[model samples]
Target: MKANGPFKILALLFVTVLAFYLIAYHTIEGRRNRNGPWIVAFTNDLSGAPALRIDHPALAITNVQLVFPDAMLPTNFTAKTILFQRPRPVPFPLPMGECIFMDTTFLPGSVVMRMSGHEVQLIPRVLTINGREQPWKSGETIALTAILTNAISPRLNGR
Candidate 1:
């Protein structure tokens, strides 16, 4: 019988490619169920408390997201500050369009916030609610004026 070297090589390549694809698919699917800390999503769902009402001055708090460092692996880090866009539309989109901290201490839903592919860090900034810090604990109610953003008068609503 005449040799069929080309056909053999092609078959080998096909098998190799198929095996690699299967391995990769299973590896990703295996990690798909892994649990991660859930950060509170600043979603536009008004069906919940802290519901965002458009036109309300407080609604000035629009998009809420957390920024984290790039050098560190998100699987083992947390966020120190939360960022939000003021005076914007409500009912934002999903995947948040921002990277959330990997730690659940910020949001305790035990859900993973799949992050965006981009990476950036936040500069040190202060948050003062009406000249004082606005510290919040879930389940507790408090109020104050806070200065956010990294620029002068970054305050929304021309504060």
Candidate 2:
């Protein structure tokens, strides 16, 4: 009877923790998918500075400047692309900036780009540019594009 009591308590604790985790995960996923998937692209502007462009089936946003802390910029001048499937984590209860777009909850994740004959992959928390991997900084601002048609690929200016 004593052994069963400890086992039951441990089982109950595990179940409670799992339930809380699942609830949180579902809530986040719900918020993320509310706006559907967005495609994000990063490329150099006319002045050779990095610029962000977003494309959605229902919205058109472009020429957004990506502000980085301490002037940190991507070393490669080529274009990078990512599919945003999750909501960007916010530190405040309410967003601080103006709501330019309807959904501002997406983040760039699992990206791939080509630069100078090298394959670059930008996964969450990891950045691989020119075949070299580095830690993706949190201070860097992210941007994304959107997919509208099944035949067209998600890219800026068709590559």
Residue-level lDDT tens digits of model 2 in 66-155:
422222234544576644564444321111111112223444334344322233453444555446676544345443232234565569
Per-residue lDDT of model 1, residues 25-138, tens digit only: 887754542322222433222222221111111213322323322222334233232323222233333333333323222212112222333322221122222233333322
Return the top candidate by TM-score: 2
| Superposed Cα RMSD, model 2 | 15.7
Question: Which consecutive 10 residues in model 2 have the weakest lDDT in total?
Answer: 92-101
- Which candidate number has the best lDDT? 2
C-alpha RMSD values across all candidates: 15.4, 15.7
Q: Measured by TM-score, how close is model 2 to the native structure? A: 0.32
Backbone collisions counted per model: 6, 5
Query: Once model 1 is optimally superposed onto the true structure by TM-score, how far is the C-alpha of residue 126 displaced, in angstroms?
Result: 19
How well does candidate 2 score on lDDT at residue 153? 59
lDDT of each: 0.33, 0.46
lDDT score at residue 108, model 2, on the 0-100 scale: 35
